[model samples]
Target: MADNYKQYTSCCQAKDWVSLSAYLGFAAAGLAVVWIPIIALAGWCALFYLLVAAAAAGVAACRWWLEVRLVCLGGDRSAIGMLVSSEPPADKSWPGSVDSDFSMNLLPYPALPGIKQADLELTSPYGFLVAEQAGTKQHVGFFTGEKATEKNGVESAILHAEFEGAGVRDVLIAVTVALGLAIAALIACVAIPPPWGLIVAGILALLAFLAALFGTLFGSGDHGAPGDVKGAPTEVHDNDPVTGLGADLLYVYGTWVFDSLHTGWNEIHPIKKCTFVGKWEGAWPADIVDVQHRLDAGFADARDPATVSRQAEDRFTWAIHPLVDGCGEAVDVPAPAQADAGLH
Candidate 1:
């Protein structure tokens, strides 16, 4: 897994260089368009200022897209979680390459279950786990499990990492190209000295400038916090507990909430959403069972007005209390009920 991750990291670094080179090429080409005119009309000092401003804008735009927007909006609500059926292999095969199943749902998409027995070698066993969507064969989020020594009779696994989507790279490339073309057009106007050419170049430059400015300001989403997406670690929790049925169990899970849903400047009232990832078995937690019961009761009493009202009240209280008080812990288990005094 470590080797595989290292390889992937190398690949990403290479890809970054490729992207940087492409952007630089575009910037150079754009500068060539206006180089002659800027030197002839504006003199050396003006030309220098123009070059510096363009470079600064280009750098700022790149950083804004890669570091800010991509980090925040790239996969804010997407994650990978694994549930291993049994202990992993002893050999140094893939760490999380045990007999396991992966399930994931990248917001606005339904939950997808991966194939039970697929080619593991073709898949990423470490770093980011990629699973083929059941029928479509499209790769979804990363998920994997690894062997772990029992700590106080409890076994656990943790996985959290950032992934860049194709969209981020595509947008960056488009902006770079646009800026380049705008410069080229302006140079053509200066060299040719045609009214039509100048008009066209001016339009193109304005459009490109607007695009860069807008993307930098509102590309990611509203309320995009730099620290939130800048290599921030995902939160995870796990523990071992004994159920009333005498079944020992180990559970692991995590949750993530997006900082903002707004994807554009005009967007308002963005849909707020969160994702939950975990693995559990046998008897579920008491709180989960209780919530299910309450929801079911609410459905059953839907025909009665008074019962419906009471159920709504209970549900609201249960749901809002955690939000109001701030749920510091991952999972909260209600205390066990006491037995009746005369029952025994």
Candidate 2:
């Protein structure tokens, strides 16, 4: 975002586009615009001044356009809801079924270091309230009544949820457009009728050039971009539960990557979703005894695997079904332990 719109700042600092555009549009529409009169009063000597002023105006307008703030996403329970449940429920869990599933890999912030989880607010467009911690990978596990096994060891059941994108790569297309416009403006400025036209065209060209350059450079949706390089899968691990409290379940571990681009300040941008599969277990052993209490009654309808996949819904509820038959003697170790003894 910084690189993409950096040029606008120079233009804006030179002059106020808001005031100038208002004046130009007003002048174009016949207002008692002061700049035109000032330029006119000064005669041919002030033509250079007029071009500078017009350029300033263009910069200001572009600033206003590119300063779009990340949209506000809401849902008080979204933070908690995302933490505790994946699919919505039908009712609280009964003896026969589970109400909600658990998501353990919800990083409350972006992958950028030094960023606080408290500073990142969850938003509707963001899809989920997750922290994008640096060097973290999301992991998923199944609940098989006895033990949940990863490639390393037996563990509890947990699902890791990560957000890919909201169709933001469309911004790249926008950047390309802006670049094209800038090139055209540059060409027109060189070939245009008068000095004033050239300045206006030149100003437009500069803004377009900045938009294109930055839009493509930092517009990527990859969480680890512009920093340290890592080759492991992107999903984070949800800690395993106590030993022996096992149940039978299926786990799907994967990573979600976002391809994004920024166009203008107020313009709506789309995001693209790309997923990388890591590990998949069809019938593994695990436990949801402790987490089971948080499931909202009847939350399964929203998280039903069939429904979850059908709607292409990114944020929804899920169930944590604890198969009664899979249980073994409960291990008296810590409640929520991360990974096995040997994992680095």
Candidate 3:
């Protein structure tokens, strides 16, 4: 089971780049429609088909933009809790492959689904871990987890990240447009004559609509669920004695809310949402620097802590809380192999 989860993690990490590729493809498909006529004149009506194709692609681009923006503005990662570890846990057994202090052994580049690299440390009976995510220009937070319900003693987790302001509206509008187009195509096919063009258009629009729906439904709670918090650590209580390691880690299974639902539609969930979970480790004031700088110059500031602390509360207290009651130690993401590694 552990191996299975690690496999899933590795696949998920690689899929980030795959998603980027898919988004670019979507954008390209949209542009292709403009050239459909030239191709059609040569032999086929490729230009007309391309125009329809482009609309679908435009929908995809809009969706990708929504996800990336949210991650940058509101996404975060942290060590939620420990998985089941009995014998001596090997570093290689986990999902992320880390080697040196800065570089990783397996996949080198950061994936697009928000999280970048994971820092795993074995602290006595429990594993102390931290996962550094992709976005840095915005804010960060921690989520929590629940006990295993499968009876295998496995840990279950979830994550909540919010997208705010006009950006959210943009994504919602795109989704509505895509769905509208698909519906139009469907009606045209059913009410009008039977033709390959209409059928193809309907199918493409439907596929795009489903993708958008999956992204949104995957991370949402039932109606009337409470809001969550962001970037707190794993929480554990000594008074509540456990037979073994308690579940305090939160692994974000998938995102529930995407940007499109609230964009042009004037739509927002009834509740303000964010990801919340239990503690993975204790919290302390972590001194943060400009992620753009890669040098070891340990220039630390005093005021930044207070500022970040307040920012943390105001932005995320409703949605999430670190498993640990307080803040964690200051940990820096090392410079990447690319020249702008620190900037990310």
lDDT per residue for candidate 1 within 182-247, as digits (tens), equals 656546555655577667666666676666555433323222111222232223223243421222
RMSD in Å for all candidates: 18.5, 23.6, 22.3
Once superposed on the true structure, which residue ranges of model 3 sit more than 4 Å away at CA?
Answer: 1-16, 19-22, 26-54, 65-344
Better of 1 and 2 by TM-score: 1
Query: So what's the TM-score on candidate 1?
Result: 0.28
Over 124-183, each residue of candidate 2 has an lDDT whose tens digit, in order, gives 222233323121112111111111233224332222332222112424344556645654
Q: Give the Cα lDDT of each candidate.
A: 0.33, 0.30, 0.30
Model 2 misses residue 296 by how many Å?
A: 16
Residue 162 C-alpha lDDT in model 3: 18
TM, every model: 0.28, 0.24, 0.24
Residue 181, model 2: Cα distance from true site in angstroms: 2.6
lDDT of 3: 0.30
Model 3 deviation from native, Cα RMSD in Å: 22.3
Any residue pairs clashing in model 1, and if so which? 33-187, 96-145
Which residue runs does candidate 1 get wrong by more than 4 Å? 1-159, 192-200, 214-344
lDDT of 2: 0.30
Error of 2 at 122 (Å): 40
Between candidates 1 and 2, the lDDT winner: 1
